[model samples]
Target: RGGCMGQCWYTAVDTQLYLIAPLLIVPLHYFKDLGKAWLYIMTLTSLIIPGAITNRSLSDHERLYVNETYSTPWCRANSWIVGIWTGYIIFKTGNQLKLKKWQVVVGWTTAFATGWMVMLGMYNVNEHEATTTYIIYEACHRAAWAACLGWVAIACHNGYGGIVNGFLSHPVWQPVSRLTYGLYLISLEVQDDLVKYSRKNLFYFTTLNM
Candidate 1:
């Protein structure tokens, strides 16, 4: 049932993570270094769990996509934990991250490299086959993607984002951001109904058409 909602599985996973957030957040607020260490451990564990599951049970790409690897909170916690870590860092630093020019350049470079790898590394992998490399990629990809996002958020908040921040923080996005939740909730069902009742076959596919 968790993964059966078409695109809405994200909502379920997010809610599950939200319910357990305080377990990390409360200690993080009160315990300082201990809380940071706990978050780091959890992040490492998040990576390990998916790798272990993939190695032990997932035999193919399709199986990996359909199985708990794609849906379960434990398997999906890498990004969530990364986000928490990012938030904690922001809070601890009072939203002021001062870095050298070289540090900023290195951070941006690393983030972009990780983001690209996560996006394109699977292009050559056989969809019907699984391997140790795929398992490692699957395990690290989500965390890497989240790390990229976390870096953007941190950099933007700290004024290091430059034009990227200008684009992202534009007022034009405010209304769209507000409507995103409603759009996400109904867009799939609306599309399904449109296809079901259409007079002609809906064959043409493109981002704008969809």
Candidate 2:
């Protein structure tokens, strides 16, 4: 709620594990009956509950230190399907059905640009800003991202795009991507305060220091 990073992680939760974990597991084992564990994980992802038993004994309104978290498992399920499909399409296009060189360049660039547009479009906007529009835009955005990632993979497969792939494959992004989980864990707790404080004392911060 405080900073851009905090909000991004929340949205990422919805985009990634929320849909992803279930998609991955559902095909293998939970096809007939998705487990309670999946539901529980997605439920907590909304982060709306009062507090768990382990909560620091915080309370609100008429309830004890507990609150209700609400989410749509169906929506999450659909998103998971879409995410997987996007990846599938990219792979098929790049491998099974090859595109002409110029076409490859066009498709790759357009896909990449579209992905950035969606990602950046959602960055500053709070999740609660406009629920319906946000949801639709995000769905489109994520689909584009999947395609973008797939195209990059395709280019790598083609072998000549080594420079681009090499950059991405570099040790630099590796650590950040690998540490994403830890970053998510630590950043969320602190971002709320940091963002709030920064906004309150805007003059105190200079962009160069960031």
Top candidate on lDDT is 1
What is candidate 1's lDDT per residue for 1-210, written digit by digit as tens?
A: 544557788788899999999989998899988988888899899999998888777546466665568878999999999999888878878766799999999999999998999999889776756487888997999999999999999999998998999999999999899999889888878899998888686597899988
lDDT of 2: 0.51
Name the regions of candidate 2 deviating beyond 4 angstroms: 1-73, 77-79, 86-97, 120-139, 160-162, 201-210
Pairs of residues at least 3 apart in sequence or in different chains that clash in candidate 1: none
Candidate 2 per-residue lDDT, tens place, 1-210, comes to 234453353464466555456545454344423443554454333222222221332234235211221123332333344444445454446545555778877877786687778768767556555544444453344345655765676667665354887887788897689888777677766877798877753456678867
Report RMSD for candidate 1.
6.2
Question: Residue pairs in steric clash, candidate 2?
Answer: 50-67
- Which window of 10 residues has the lowest lDDT sum in candidate 2? 64-73
Predicted structure with the largest TM-score when compared to the true one:
1
